[model samples]
Target chain A: GAGVSQSPSNKVTEKGKDVELRCDPISGHTALYWYRQSLGQGLEFLIYFQGNSAPDKSGLPSDRFSAERTGGSVSTLTIQRTQQEDSAVYLCASSLWMGGPEAFFGQGTRLTVV
Target chain B: SQQGEEDPQALSIQEGENATMNCSYKTSINNLQWYRQNSGRGLVHLILIRSNEREKHSGRLRVTLDTSKKSSSLLITASRAADTASYFCATDALQGAQKLVFGQGTRLTINP
Candidate 1:
């Protein structure tokens, strides 16, 4: 796809289970970001991968949330021991540079933990 | 905490009427951008205003930035039913790794 691509548009999981979401960024894009949006709420930054630099995980809600970008292209977000509170739409975006430019977004993965 | 906060959580206007959304940020920013999302899906970039730029225009969309005030506004002229969507303001902070921080967003509805 020319734009950012996310896998498993919708996922339903049991509480305490784990799930993984995948994202494929645009070709040659150096920056990728993950954000979580709850129903009727704003997006919360989760983690960011920029080039070869370390990812900034300041926005991660807990240790259970972790993400990795392999070869600076495809990325995966893993949630361990998912809780009801983890139910939300996970959005992925990619940009040509680190900042100061428009970003391309994926359709997002709606995860429901019952 | 989110860096940007949008005003008027929800808005509805008649067709042909202009709609405006405002966003305020907590810190210095390199640039501010507006995006629109439909049905909580992928968001499409609308416009971007750099801190050095006071205002910019793209088609019927106008964006204004006030660096000193740390605020920005997105004005859509000639509203249409197709324009109904959730609009969010994202800021590229000057500090840190220069990641974009998003605002809660404004839900705009246009009636024909």
Candidate 2:
């Protein structure tokens, strides 16, 4: 893809239900990031992947939050036992390289946990 | 935790006027970037100033960074209605792989 792509523009799930969000980063990009944005709040870092290395998952809010990237192209963010507080816009971004290059963002998936 | 904090949560200005927003961060950063979001859309990168740089400009956007004070500001000159959006400041710490820590953002409304 020419830019970062995110799936399921919007998702509404019952509380306690599990959900998965997908992100397709730009081709040849080596760094991918996930962020959560709540209403009137800044983006919260969730995870970061640099190539095939172990991801930086320090920002995952809880054990229910997990993510995986395969082939260094596509990634998935999984939330188990979702809570109402989990509702937010999940943003995915990709950069050609890490730390120095500019990043491009996806439209994001608005997750609404009922 | 949010490492950056933006001031004047909301600002309203008439078209053709200039708008300035300030951001403060806690830790030393390798670089700081500004982004803008319209309504519920994705963010668009505006400008980036490295720790070694003090100021940068792009079109009507001017950005300044004071690393000594751990603060930055974004200035939009001769704003237009299309410029109405939420602006955010993101910081990339010295030890991370560009994992950005963003501020709450400043909502700017340009009145016609």
Best by DockQ: 1
Give the winner by TM-score.
1
lDDT of candidate 1 over A15-104, digit per residue (tens): 999999999999999999999999988889999999999999999999999999999999999999999999999999999988748899
Query: By summed lDDT, which 10 consecutive residues of candidate 1 chain B come out lowest?
Result: B91-100
Q: How accurate locally, in lDDT, is each candidate?
A: 0.93, 0.91
Q: TM-score, each model?
A: 0.98, 0.96
Model 1 chain A poorest 10 in a row by lDDT: A94-103
Off by over 4 Å in 1: none
Clash pairs, model 2 backbone: none
lDDT of 2 by residue, A1-114 (tens): 778899999999999999999999999989999999998777888999998788999999999999999999999999999999999999999888775467899999999999
Pairs that collide in candidate 1 are: none
TM-score of chain A of each: 0.98, 0.98
What residue runs in model 2 are displaced by over 4 Å at the alpha carbon?
none
